[model samples]
Target chain A: MEAPDSNIAIAAAGWHFLCERAEILVLRVSREGAILHANRHAVELTGIPLEGEPLEHIFLGFADGPVGRRLLDRTGETHLANIRTANGLPETLYFTALPAGDEMVLFGQTDAQEQVRLRKEVLALNHEMGNLSRELTQKNAELAWLNAQKTQFLGMATHDLRKPAGLILSYAEMLEEEASGTLREDHLHLLDTIRASAERMKRVIEDFLDVAMIESGKLNLDMGVAAIEELVKSPLLLVSKSASRRGVVVTTDLAPAGQRLRVDGQKLEQVITNLLSNAVEQSPDGATVQVGSRRHGDGIRFFVTDAGKGFSEEVRGRLFTAFAGTGGQKRDGERSIGLGLAISRRIVEAHGGTMMAESPPGKGATVGFILPAQCLAPMRSDEQNGGVR
Target chain B: MSEQPGSDPRVDSVYDRYLASLLEGERTECTSVVEGLRAGEVPLRSLYVDLFQRALYQVGDLWEQNRVSVATEHLATAITERMVALVEPGVFGGEARRRVIVVACVADEYHQLGGRMAADLFELHGWRAYFLGANTPHSSLLDLIEKTKPDLVGLSLSIYFNLPSLLAALDAVRAAHPDLPIIVGGQAFRWGGEESLRRYEGVTLVKTVDDLERIATGHGSP
Candidate 1:
């Protein structure tokens, strides 16, 4: 065959280059959102075919979201949406305007299935909302009822039982003290009985108190902004006495002078101090106590770890509870009102955060808490001046 | 995604001929956010954490099944963390109007995918989720319970055998918050764990998305 002109050969090669190098899904359409052209990939996806067909003719096979319809209505208005190929599969379609002189060339391609799945998710979310709303209402109701029961229970215990128990405990203690003077052998046994009964009454009253405070939502938080540096020092100093009493070496990992944290210095200090004391009480003398903090997420996380006997799953279940000490059994002076942790939790929560304990039997225990950095929403001028009267 | 344009009838590909090609292993759709996540520029909720519980786990499974290795899992985790970071800033602990609940596997319980999945689901559904990262101590959990007193307690157990211990923990919480709803989900429910969970009152079990919706409704799933 005679050699074709160099110009003709060059044009043919250029056309092939445009097809292979570019990722455009070219389509031809009329003014009415009908399909006029469908590129190779677009044709592969939709399963519909031929050189001439309206867009809507094939779209009926699949569902469409708001973004999809908008693409069809606006000629020059382009949209990025997921579209189903004829195979009924979804694609993250990137529809763009391919200006073609007199006619508009509709160029499109997909981003990925992940994008399309997300869109469908928005529609599916309606169902979840309904579920959440219902769950919220029901849970709220349950909580309200439980609170009421706790209130009633506490009232009876404090007024009807606690006073009478106090009377018994007082007399028992008095008799035991008075008997010391008699110093008689027979009387010694009687004094022991009285003291024992007095201790029993005290234990009952304490348990009721734990139940009362945790349920009634009456825990008080003495709030303040204590520098993290100063905060760690106070707790460490306070717990030193208790630590030495039990032979535990207490350590404080305070951030430098510049590392400050907002807390109700009094309450947060009490929480740490109690946790510190609890550590001493749990561990044998000479064990190590580790106190430290680091940036955990968008908040600050403080931890108190003790190298001690650790805790059983059973004892740990009641760890922070009143009279629910771990290890072998509940010991004297170590009897938790259980109120400490509950109270501490309330204070931390009031400051907007969470606290937790981690102890595996034989592995020791670690208590940690995370508090969010302070927010900067300005209160209304009047609201700040006085409690909204 | 809106409906796709049909094939041009002029071309052919084997994938176009079969519907099964698109249906298998399909996952939660999240794009426009993947690039930033892969680049480590945004967190998962930002885009890295964007992979839903199922999608990311698949990446994990590929490694777990020995099809991939630790390096691949690490890459995926890095991508996930970055995505999570992207969205984490948007989620704040400042809001307390809605109870922010958290749940996790006990230290005795080894698997955590179930718990992580639950947390991811909660975040996607727009609830404040406190993910008690796995292997948490019972002491810490009890402390968390007292501290968070979340509206609901969601616990996940992957192995049926661990049901007894899971129930024990639930009982412990019951001692603290008798009214707090304890929701038990994950694989444990399938291994005839429903009967085990039911023995404890105030404890609800979920086996499906519908059950979860039931939980979201406030009836507390059963």
Candidate 2:
């Protein structure tokens, strides 16, 4: 005869609901003794209803082949061979039991819902990993492309510099030969052309070199004591012929602006030269270009004023941008690819000073730069300023 | 260390920005402000109207200092406009106030961000604002005012050059609508709102968002 109904039945009904609601399931078998009872896990697991049917039919069903007999024949708790579901699902099941009177087994099938969720999670993680790998690969490819481009750029810039640099040296040679004697007036003109072209080439090469050095982190400036005279006279003397030809008058009142302090003299000369020559080119024929210097507190300020076609709002907008010259640009709407002002600007900045410009359209233009006066040699006021001493 | 996204060390730096400042167009500070806005820990609007706008006004002082250019000053202005647009959505959402008509002065005025700021503030506060672009024709402005009959007409001026036109715009509005309220704001009025507020005989001049609140809420000036 059957004993009074056990507390396991109430729990079995609750387990049924947990399974149906959220796709969950629970199986309760006696872990103490021989075959007590089985729950309705079979309704979903065995795919059949056996509300009061004998427990043996479904116990055999919960196991496949001879697995059930081996399990029942045992008395105390024993780990049965990983039992298989009837549908041939690949999962391992374990059972515990009691031997005396009516023993019991507790076992549960693997939750299909959990398996599906884990499968999706694993798939998503794998896809994300793959995407990261692809992105890394793409970045490496981009880096390689950029390196190659940089090499090509340097190669081309060097080649470009060589072509003009060779001409500049050869032109200087011709100028030296002509300067002594046996130079015709036309030869003088050709010499002028050579010098101008050489200057232009030198400007380009210098800019290319400066940019390269700056890019490679090798642009260390050497500061020294340079006279204000050298900075003003050198560029003026170099561009003298061009100024004369263009009918532009370049006047300088160097007049010992300040104490020669610690500074990079060569680059300072280059800056003043660039500002003056650029002014000469932009000014109309027969215009006045004035260059002056004055002590500005701890620094000296240099100004180059050109009385030519002043900068328009358009040109002023793009003035400091490299390769954007002011002359043929306004006339033919053409711009230069030269690095004149760009190199000058870079050099000035390297010396720990600032450069600025003032160009009111139709009022001509003035370019100014300030350098600390600690780098220049002190000026002699005697003969230089009309021999007062 | 938290890294700001667009700030690449390999690219342009603070020195480059400084050089840009000494010459014409925008200073490095303009781009830095944009960078700050993009990072977005605090509301960009409050930061802008509070700090950035004051900083930009200092830039205007630099313009008066004889070293800076109109290009430089205007560049900062243009960049601030972009900043305003960038932060607008996060502060006010994407929905625009389609009903209110935003009235601004003519193009010769050339400066109207102060007006645009009010418009943005109004939009954030939940009124549909229609911007009358810049330097619009008088006939068109009046016609739009008549057609739209905006709940409020917000007038902005940033330069003294546009004062005559601003007054004319105000007068036209008065002739057109007797009951409709008008609010004026901008930089040209040095005393902020105190002087301009008293000066506007027939219109209301709001110095800031604080003053604008009273006018916007219908308790307009006498």
Candidate 3:
């Protein structure tokens, strides 16, 4: 071998140093396609040692072939390759190969123009997303405002109609009392129909008021301590009267009979009233409606079971939705307004409780609510002695 | 620019950390920093102007001075965009006033974060803000105005080179809705364009989020 010139050697060393520090990737591979050396940039970019590895390992989308040899054959032509980077993402790089002595040298650089195009596309997509998001936000605001307006209108209309409904109910009751003995049989039956219609109307109006208040986010509660047994028994008085008229028996099984909890006494009584009424309305003639309360998982669970045709899965799903009309017919063929259960559930939820309904096929249905332990207020002497004030 | 009211001094360090993470493309770290500030109850306006806006400006400056590569600046911008979106849920809360404003970037103006932040500020002040994102065409903008019947329109301009496009958009809006109010602002106004904006009537140049807030709440004119 001839001795290399010192000046040529020095220039070669300087070029080697430049290649090592270059921002682009530089690699020297053997003829067989195994990497002989990788520059600093190449190692740093890939975050792996490159010596003695096949050059194809760094590039993606190569078939089972000698990729390095083919690239070496195309000496000065640029080939686009996606180089796997350290960050677990592929980066597209343009590469050129050159024959050097008994090996091939590769240089890789990022395609700036391609990057610019990609950046533009990404920015456009991002802008589209942002515009859609803005539209959605605006639409949501409009819908909320419209809903508020509807709720306000509902509240006002219900408030105004409630007065007329009460007047009709009062007049019907007064006429029923004053003309019970003097009227003819048919006349008395007509008077009874009028009273029944007025009572139904009053119930429907009251349910509407409850729904309106709940929808307007104004379901205020006047919280007080009450015994669970008293709460259960108070509504039974009103419910038993209607149940007996249908030949349905009303019963109660309050286990923790003396259990006292903090709740809105009036609202809790309304919930019991709603549940018992619904049970009585759905019960078959001579069937029984049972009300029960017991300790359940650090809470008190109250449930009403009725011997009526069970609800299907579909009806059970929306049983507590207002105006869902899942409420069955009474013995007199009078339909319920379907807002009682919904309002009852809302009242229970306001007291930090949850409502549920279970109906087995060919069996009866049971609707229940559980008030959390947070509602279990210590019984004051006055509340205990005065029977749940 | 004056510091925004409710700006916390603690956010200065958070801004530095966020800018560093953004420039390095560490998205998770940036998210953590932003979430931390939000959890600490740093006011939304301060998060926008003090942290996000200030860091982006610094990143732009770094690119101008050649201290950072253009790719790094763009990475910072992309991260900041995500961070801004992270703050959006907090932006749309509170009761909405019955006013509506349509915000858009002028044609060929792609830097839209500032305008987006401004729209969010309006939302915070209870005005329903509809943001039409970057490079919005004049015709489409006019069509939206016709459809939405907005009470006000806002145009954003980022680069000074887009001043002509902004002016064209302004003229299109003015010709269509003669009595409609308009507000214009962005980094482009920092260099110039405010004087040119004076040619149109009922067009105000809002310079800060506070100014936008005052205008949105009907307390001050822009």
The candidate that achieves the highest lDDT relative to the unseen native structure: 3
lDDT per residue for candidate 3 within A1-389, as digits (tens), equals 44679778987887687577668888998877889999998998999999989898897656746555667778999987787899889987888998889988898998778879998898788778866766676566667778777778878887998888888878878978997888899988888888888888878878877888999889999988788887877898988788887799988898675778889999999999988888887788899999998888888899999998878999988999987777667667877668888999899999999998999877798998999988876556645587432
Q: What is the lDDT of residue A75 in candidate 3?
A: 91
Error of 2 at A350 (Å): 0.8
Q: Candidate 2 lDDT, tens digit per residue, A1-389?
A: 43446557766666567546433223333432223334555456555454444434554344355554555556455553443345866444455444433444444445567756765455445433433343344345446557556645864687677776877767677666757377788877777677756765665566666666655556677777656766677889977998899788888887455445467777777778878877887788888899988777767778899886666677665665564664345222435464666666677777766777887767888887777544444445543776421
RMSD of candidates 1 onward, in order: 22.6, 29.9, 5.6
Model 2 residue A266 CA deviation (Å) reads 1.0
* Best candidate according to DockQ: 3
Against the native chain B, each candidate's TM-score is 0.62, 0.73, 0.93
lDDT of 1 by residue, B19-58 (tens): 1211222212122234334455433332212233333445
Which regions in candidate 1 have their CA more than 4 angstroms from the true location? Answer: A1-143, A159-179, A183-215, A224-262, A285-302, A311-328, A331-339, A359-363, A371-389, B1-222
Residue B7 of candidate 1: its Cα lDDT? 23
lDDT of 1 at A284: 71
- C-alpha positional error of residue B142 in candidate 3 after TM-score superposition, expressed in Å: 0.9
TM-score: which is higher, 2 or 3?
3
DockQ of each: 0.02, 0.01, 0.30
User: Which one wins on TM-score?
Assistant: 3
TM-score of chain A of each: 0.46, 0.50, 0.77
Candidate 2 stretches greater than 4 Å from native: A1-152, A159-199, A255-258, A323-335, A372-389, B1-222
